[model samples]
Target: MPTAIIAEDEDLLRSELRRMLAECWPELEVLAECEHGADALEAIERLQPDVAFLDIRMPGLSGLDVAHAVSGRCHAVFTTAYDQYAVEAFAAGALDYLLKPVAKARLEQAVTRLRERLRLSETAPDIGRLMAELDRRLRPQVETEQRIRWISASVGDTIKLFPIEQILFFESDEKYTRVVSGEDEAHVRKPLRELVAGLDPEQFWQIHRGVVVRAEAIARARRDELGRITVELRGRPERLKVSQAYAWRFKAM
Candidate 1:
């Protein structure tokens, strides 16, 4: 039986993919399920599964990063929530791309293609072109005028609006995100990923999978002897952990 691994950040989505796979490819053996890109990379290296289903956006090493590092060691199918630009890029590059909320028919089609490739002993797809396209799409483009100005969060039964200037950081908490400003904190139904899309990337930096801190509020970034990176925010007691994928942001500092 062919072995495969699924890498996705959202628990529900990961589980759903597993369920769909079981239904479509009953003979296929799922070797592992990973919640982040770092873990997914480790699993892929160790297991050397026949195929890997990678989510494009992840905490540490993103799916594209994993694919680039692996260098076509195993067949890869990318899952993305990117817009038309990325879709067009994937189509032009002839890369296997699955849209988020993966449809059963589409997955079945992917499975058929994988089976044929495996049966014929075909080489892995050329990921270099896909990586180049991804790099182009993911480049940080400034959107100065559209930055968020106010955040409305739920504080118990009442709703409170906090100006963007007063906010210090946003931390993911299960289904909701905790917005922190000075000594006050409130919860919002929005996830960190969605919030990051609207927030100015120059102003707010995502340090970890679940943490986004304001650039001006950050006092300093410290690295321990072990090479672990952490950021200390101004007037905040807690230090935020920085994932390896985003550590490049503090390279100069």
Candidate 2:
């Protein structure tokens, strides 16, 4: 019997999927159900289930994020609603996908495919190219939804709301995003990726894996002694490294 785990944000959908799995695939044991990507990643790391039914989008980490974290640990069956890009990627990868409100017929088909692959003794499904394509198609959609308007931070017991425009940069350290405004900085609970979405791209540019700087605050770009490019912020000497992949963002600087 294959052990499976479900990772989804919505409680109703998670329960419904569990009920459907019980009715349709009785042999598969549901080892766990996670409500967010961070929790799901930890669960998958611990359980090491044979199948993971992951919702494509979630607050913390995406289903794809979980998949990337647990690469080759188990088969990934993505559950998404109206994400045609991910659906097509699943089809292309020869992996299974359960559309939201998971139709019985589709679920059955997915089970059949899973069984066939098991019988064939396939070691792992190749999902790299498929995931890349899905990211490409959904990047714009993700960016559109990542607008930061009101920011809530706290100095002590009292909370404060700072307009997004007041932020000069975002720095990631120890899994926390630190918002910087000139010399003043404050900590926020949101992760770097989450903060990136909430920020305006025209104003913020991710210059490094750990740093996203305000575009208007860029003072200049210069190559270091090691031939690596780094950016300096206006009126600030804190140099931020620019990865080659994201160097295009500072091309005009």
Candidate 3:
């Protein structure tokens, strides 16, 4: 039987994919499942499965990074929530990509393609060009107006607004995000994913799946004996854990 691995950050989505795969490709064996890019990379390297279903935007290495690193080694089907531009790029490259919420019909189509490629022993898609096109579409353009300027969070019973510059970090709570400034902290209804989309990427860095910190507020990044990177904010005693996928951002510093 063919072997496969699923890499997705969201637990529910990952489970859904597994369920769909069981129904669609009952003969295929799922070797492993990973929730972060780094873990997925490691699993891919160790298991070397026949196929990998990777989520494009994951905490740690990202599906693109994993696919690039393991080029030609396995059949890769990317899962993404990106727009039509990315989908067009995938189609142009003859790459297999599944849109989010992964409908049964679409997934069946992807599985059919996979079976054909495997049966004929086709080469992996040229991920280089596809990556370039994806980068061009996903990278933030020089539009200052699009950057979020102010953030409103609830401080007890009152709502307070803080300038974007004053904010030090945003950490995801159960259903809301906790906004922290120098000494003040407040909770907001906005999720981390939505906040990340509006925030300036250069100014704010997502160190972990649940954390986004201001670049200026970052005092230093340190790696432990195990080579796990963690960031310390300027005045904050808490050291934030950085996933391996995003460790490259702190490599220079």
Tens digit of per-residue lDDT, candidate 1, span 67-130: 6556667878888777332432232222367888899998887787677657545453664564
Residue 99 alpha-carbon offset, candidate 1, angstroms: 5.0
lDDT of 3 at 87: 29
Instruction: Estimate, for each residue in 101-216, the C-alpha lDDT of model 2 and write its tens digit.
Output: 89987887777766655544444377566555643443223213536787787888978776778777888977678888875778888888667655665677766657888888
Clashing pairs in 3: 60-245, 61-245
Please give the distance, in angstroms, between residue 224's alpha carbon in candidate 1 and its true position after superposition.
1.0
Worst 10 residues of 3 by lDDT: 85-94
> How many clashes in each structure?
0, 2, 2
Error of 2 at 227 (Å): 24
| Model 1 TM | 0.53
lDDT ranking, best first: 3, 1, 2
What is residue 226's positional error in candidate 2, in angstroms? Answer: 23
lDDT values for all models: 0.77, 0.72, 0.78
TM-score of each: 0.53, 0.50, 0.56
Shift of residue 167 alpha carbon in model 3, Å = 1.3
Instruction: State the displacement of the C-alpha of residue 156, model 2, in Å, after optimal TM-score superposition.
Output: 38
Deviation in Å, model 1, residue 170 alpha carbon: 0.5
- Scored against the true structure, residue 60 in model 2 reaches a CA lDDT of 68
Q: Model 1 RMSD to the real structure?
A: 8.1
RMSD vs true structure, all candidates: 8.1, 10.2, 7.2
